[model samples]
Target chain A: MPRHELLTGNEAVAHAVAMAKADVIGIYPITPQTTIIEEICNLAANKTFSPKIVHVESEHSAMATIIGAAFTGVRTFTATSSQGLALMHELLHWAAGGRLPIVLANVNRAMAPGWSIWTDQNDSLSQRDTGWMQFYCESAQEVLDTIFLAYRVSEQVLIPSMVVLDAFVLSHTSEPVEIPDNETINKFLPNFTPSFKLDIDNPCSFGALLRPQFYQEVRHKLNDAMSEALIKINESDKLWKQLTGREWGIVTEYRADDADYLFVTSATTASTAKPVIDKLRKEGLKIGLIKIRVFRPFPFEQVKKYLTKCKRAIIFDRNISYGHHGIFAQEIKSALYGVKNSPEILCYTGGLGGKDITPQLIEETIIKGTKTKLNGSLFEWI
Target chain B: MPIKSYEVRFHGRGGQGVVIVSKIIGYAAFLNKSYIQCFPEFGVERRGAPVKAFLRISNQQIFIRSSIEKPDCIVVLDPMLLSQHDTLAGASSDCLLIINSRTADLQIQKSFNNICVVNASDIAVQNGLGTATTPIVNTAIAGAFAQATEIIQMKHLEKAILKYSPAKIQENVKAAYQAYNTVSKPIPLK
Candidate 1:
């Protein structure tokens, strides 16, 4: 029997971690993401879940602790946001290169020049080169399912996975979610099996500095693993859907068939676009939405297959790259570079600092982007 | 399509955990086999900033994705948030407005057709809870909500509370019962 529960996106992540039977959690509280650790602590206190809760001094220490825990062959997890994620930047690279399958929930918040605690995609997007597989969720239910899938994908590919949700917009927002049955989840995800561990009997060097000859090889191996991860991620997602009856893959397409115009976005922004898509479809507009659930590994093949055939596209990003344009938009446009008959991609940056992106705004932006005659100058604030 | 959804909005400050109040309500409805959705809207104000959380409950899947523009019920967790903006916007003429305030002025009383006032902070403090942050008001409000419409049974709320809450469940039950009895019905202004 399915159980319905009202849970914030943060709480949903914590619940999924508990369901995954994580052995150790190294967490430090940060805004928007703080409730995740709080819920975990409360669960620990109530003996609802028996995971070890290690309170660290800072996000840096939190990441280090998870790394150590993962190295010791234990299922490990943590949550952080914005500056906290920035603090864990170095360890993020370490976790990936060390090949520890640690799972992290990053509540996306804007970086500070003005000390803001609102939602944005920059915090996680800025870490695009860190080698961590990223999944951006569209709803609380997706947050729960993605975290469970993250563990499977990370362990299978030996790459750390970060599940990103908008800070206050999704993290603090509550929604009705179907908490999967324990047996179903268990049947879907078996007990985690670490590929390598630090054992006293079998002593091996980890993170050792290499000479130039070996350094290139080590990086090549990391790049190979990233390439392999793309396949593993899709495979795991496919298996997960078969087991749980929830579909989550590299990207989710909404009414893309016969679509002349496409609007691309991720996270909660995708949820905001659904109603607008329905309204536009009724008004005889051949429009559609493409939600990019997986950020790392780019999903370029799928993007080209699904969106390149459209007449035009609009890339709406909640994060900016300062001097240029939306980070993901720039990346998507680059992915299609030199491809013949590729859709004209326009970029719109909105929802920064937690601004609400209503359905009206999404409709207006799509209508304007599809009709605009300008090429690169279609960037407008909604 | 049948329209059977009930939307409730709660207004409060950032530190007050007003969002949790809506979650509890939605959970209780879920326990009764209803579909529900709850979410919070917050500004940049850190500690003392005003915040709002909205809830929608029905027997079928809810399709509305926007905030509660027209609320059937409005709960004011902090009376101070009421002073900042017009709380009556999108409020139905027959809406039940519950405010956590000490004042009983006629002007405030005349703002709505159905009003209920309770000093939930006082009850929370009296119960030895440190701050009225989130107050014991959620429980009281839950009781009043039940009494107002009887959409959910008292037993359903009890089960939901036991499942979700760990501390001060007994006190909360007491607060709920107290509020059920003390809340006065809205009277027309003279």
Candidate 2:
């Protein structure tokens, strides 16, 4: 029987990893992400979980250790946040390029020059091209569920996955989560048995240097694998829903059916935007919200499907690309390029450094967006 | 009818178990079969440094995941934080204020209409929850919170304290009940 427990987002991740029966976990402690490993240690100390917990000196080594462990045909996991994530950038590509099916929980903290430990998307968004699929979660339950879904998809597609939650908003937030039973979890995720791995008896070279003769083809095959990952993710999501009676869509469309104005955002901001949309709707505003759950796959088709008929789309991005637009805004603009009668998109950047995104602030942004004229520039700082 | 929700912000020094207070309340609400979300204000915390934690309890699922801006109730584990001006910045006029002070100051009584003062620090010391220099008032304050707000009952809070209190479980529960019985009734603004 499924049992409910009051767990913080970090605790939920630890529970999921333990329940998944991961063979190894490599972790380097960082703010917001530290409690995850700490909880795992507690579970291990209680003799309830028995995975080999590697206490690495740095985030770079943590990712590298997990990659090596996963190559031995075993389930592996790790977690980090902000500066810790930046330190793992090189190995992020290494893990993906080496095709290791490792799952990482990234607590989204602001990248610091002034030294902030608050929530933001820039840290994770900076790793956009690392070839790892990313899912931004809205709640502790979603964070826990996405870990399982990520593992299922990553193992099937032979790619790594990163599950993101806001630093304090969800990472430290405690909420009730219905933990799936061992019987159901085992049914959903059997032991990881990779077709190709570092086997002593089969002695085959892995990640050897390749000349220009077939390097492009290797990259092409990786690209094709990403495409296959999309299908696998959907299939995994359906199976998880069937097993658990819950499903978080790749991109959740909230009351977007007949609205002319749509609000586009991700993570906790999307959670806050819903009530604002509801309040506006009560006052006769035809506005809706679209939460981008899966950021890696981009969900281009799903995004276009929802915004094609709307008159305008307002995007709130908690991250800014210094010389360019907000990362999500840029991806959305590209996703809507050349689409027939697409909504006029406006991007507003705010909530960086973990600033509060209150319902009033969201309403103010909507009111400002409704009055703005597109003068060849569609960006503003809220 | 829409489900009712209550947002609470807790103010205390770092070693006072400020974050744990919010968790205790969340656990109590969970035991009552209500939904809850609790989180601390992320920062570099040190002993004696002021810290804040937040909680939201609702009869239905809470979709919004943001810091509490205008809290419906405020719990002050340290009386000194009340001296800081911003402690009650976003609270509404009718907001419930529960402070861990041995005696209610006139200034606080003049400023807030709904205020309750409890000697949680003294009670905690008597119960041996922490040393006198840094008495852990979280459990005691939680008990006062239950008596004042009625958001949760004494029975649920006792169970939560027993389940979550780190050490001296019976002492902590005794501290909570003592505070619950001894906490001063709310005094209207003068």
Candidate 3:
């Protein structure tokens, strides 16, 4: 029988890493993401697990350490948020380009200007082109499951993966998590067999500087590998469901079928949308929610299939793309640009800087966006 | 079912380690093979800003994901939070209320069958642990909690502290015992 326990999203990540038997964990303390490292360190100290816990000085060092460990065929893990993740941006690309399958838990916090520690998707969204697979988890249980599955997807496709959760929203919130038994998790995620390793004995060169002539082809190959990763993501999700009896696809559709309007979001925002959707459904609103679980390699085909049927769609983003609009909104619009009968998509941005997006706000935005017909760009900032 | 679950909420500021205190309680229960869950809630508030932590422990699984609207026990790390927010909003008549306050004359409007008032800060200071922070009060509060309901034994709390705490094991254990003696039960409002 599956054992059910209550765990915070951050603690769930720690538990997941322990279950995966990650050889090394490189982490630094940052808001929301801090408890994850703290718990992992505590676990290591208590001898609950024997993973080598390295307390790096900064998020940059944390990312670099994980990259180095992953290259040497060690299943490594790390975590960060907002400014922390932003600091690790350069190494994030390096980890991906080198095809090192590292798993990171990014507790999503808003990027600063006014200094916000609240939940937002901007940090991870900004690194969309970094070639790392990103999974935005909606609950504590999802956080656990996604971390386990991240290793599978990354190791199989040789692409690093990040499991993103809201800063304090999901990160600190404890919920009932049915933790899969060790044997079950072990069966689902086999010991990470490296596709390639830096062997000093064999004298193989890794990440040698590429000249301009060969750089494009190398970049092209990396992009092609990412495309191939999309298939592995689906396979991993399927395998996870079979083992754990929990169904999680790249994009989770909630009442999207036969709907006139759609709301797109990720992470804890999906939970916030549930009550709003429930209220709207009672008022005869044919609206639905589409949660983007997997943000990287952008599930364009699946998004197109569901979104193309809706008459109007509103992209609700917790993260802003500066002068333009919501990052996810922009990406969704780009995905549907060539599709026939694409929904009239609108962008609604709020909940930045830790501001709460209540059910009333969601309901009001949907009603306003659906009622109005704008000229030129359909995107409007809420 | 026979009996459902018990929910306890802790109120304090950001730096006071409210979440960690609740986690200790939850972890102790979990170690005893009880179903347990604990979490913290904070806004844009920085250090010293008011924060809250919630815990639910039961014999069976707990499904409620929302905040503890009706808490069986309310543990207040700071007495000021009681006046600043509705810390006792959904407390039942039988609900046990524990507060770490300096004001001896402070009173609750609603008459609860069980309540505990302790000057945990004073106890902590007397014990040579600087500041009446969450760590000092947490063990004391846990002791008071154990005394009030006996939900978790004093030995279980001591075991948990010894297990998780590395340096301040002896001081924390002393504080827990001190709290068990000092905390006053809820008295009916005249």
Candidate 4:
């Protein structure tokens, strides 16, 4: 039986990781993201969780250690934020190219040049082409549930996955999460064993220098796996939903049917935009919200199919693409290209450095999207 | 049925545990059948620097993830913070103001809203909960909020504070009672 536990998003992820029985857990403490590793450390110290908890000197070492462990073909987990994730840039690609199904929970924070510990998407969005599967969660429950889902999909496809959520918005905020029993999780996700491993009996060279021809084939294989993982994502979501009676698909609809205006958002902003959508709808406007939960595989086809109903669309992004438009807005435009009757897309960026994205701001964004003159500017920062 | 949502903001300095105060209030509200969210606001966390923590409670889950700009109530944990006089800048028109000072009545000018006061620092010190120099008034104010605004019950605040306090649970509980007993009736300024 499931029980409702009031937990922060960090605690929920830690709980999920514990239930998943990750073979290795490596972490370094970073603000907002620290409490998560702290919870995991406490669990390990108390013997509730048995994974080797490594308190590495730095975030880079944390990722490096996980890479070596994941290459052995065991379930592995790590958590980081902002500069910590940035420090793992080299290994992020390595984990993907090495075909290691490593699951990372990245609490997204604004990158430092100005040195801020606030929530933002730039940290993860900046790594858009890292070839890792990405899932942006909106609530604590979703944050917890995505861990199992990310691991399942990653392990099945042999691709790394990043479960991203806003720093304080979801990370520190507490909410009631239905925690599924360990037996149920074990049944859903059995102990992970890699299809191929670094075993002495079946010794094989890994991550060696490759010519362009061989490298292209390796890259192609990664793409094929990522494409296949989309189906696995849907499969995992369905399986979890069937077992736990809770489900979050790649794209969650918010009263979007029979509506022509849509708010395309991810993470906490999607939830904030929802009530505004409802309020507008109550006032006889047909505005709707479409939460893109899974960002890695892009869900381009689904985005196109669902977006066909929109007369206008607003892509609310927390990340600013310097000298250009909001990152998600840019991605949506790319996704909607050549599709007939695609909505008129507008991008609005705010909530940088942990600024609040109130329902009022969301409503204003909707109104702006509906009435903008569209003088060819990429986006306007609110 | 519609869910009513209320926002509470805390103004204080660092090291006073205002952040945890917000969390305790949130936990209490959650246990009381209200969906709760709380977070701290500051550019850099330094001791003696002004810091703010916010809380929101609704019968349904709150979707807005932002700082409480227009709070229904504002609780000031440090009486010294009143000297700058920018405490209740964005409070709602019909706000409830709770302060942690014996002389708060003299400080607040006449306003249409209600003003309630309790010497929370004295309560904390009287109950031997905080040090003499850095008196901790957060837990006391959590109790004061319950008494002054009736947004939360006494039992719920006690349940949350004692459960979450690192040490001196008994002392904190006593301080809570001290504030609960001492908070003045809301001065309704006509």
- Across all models, the iRMS values in order are 3.2, 1.9, 5.6, 2.4
> Which digits, one per residue and each the tens of the lDDT, describe model 4 over residues A149-232?
998888899999999988888888777788998888987897787777898899988899999879999999999888899899
Q: What class would a CAPRI assessor give candidate 2's docking?
A: medium
Better of 3 and 4 by TM-score: 4
Question: For model 1, what is the C-alpha lDDT against the true structure?
Answer: 0.81
Error of 4 at A7 (Å): 2.1
Off by over 4 Å in 1: B1-5, B12-17, B43-51, B58-70, B77-82, B90-96, B99-105, B108-136, B149-151, B161-171, B174-190
Model 4: per-residue Cα lDDT over B1-190, one tens digit each: 2254698888999999988899888888877888887877735679999998888889887877777878888888887776655677776558888888866455554264787788887788888876877898888888888888777887888889877899889888888878888776787755
Q: What is the DockQ for all candidates, taken in turn?
A: 0.39, 0.69, 0.21, 0.55
For residues A60-89, could you state the per-residue lDDT of candidate 3 as single tens digits?
999999888888899999999999999999
Q: What is candidate 2's lDDT per residue for A318-368, written digit by digit as tens?
A: 999998879999999999999998889999999999998888899999999
Q: Each model's TM-score, in the order given?
A: 0.88, 0.97, 0.80, 0.95
Question: Which candidate has the top score in TM-score?
Answer: 2
Which parts of model 3 have CA positions greater than 4 angstroms off?
A: A376-382, B1-9, B13-17, B20-38, B43-50, B54-80, B85-190
Q: Count the backbone clashes (under 3 Å) in each candidate.
A: 0, 0, 1, 0
RMSD of each: 3.6, 1.5, 5.1, 2.0
Best candidate, DockQ-wise? 2
In model 1, what lDDT does residue A247 have? 79
Model 2: per-residue Cα lDDT over B1-190, one tens digit each: 2243799999998899999999998899899999999988778889889899999999888877777878889998888787787688788778889989877653552266788889998999999989888898999999899888878888899889988888899999999999989976676755
In model 2, residue pairs whose N, Cα or C atoms come closer than 3 Å (at least 3 residues apart or on different chains), thus clashing, are none
What's the CA RMSD of model 4 in angstroms?
Answer: 2.0
Judged by TM-score relative to the true structure, which candidate is superior, 1 or 3? 1
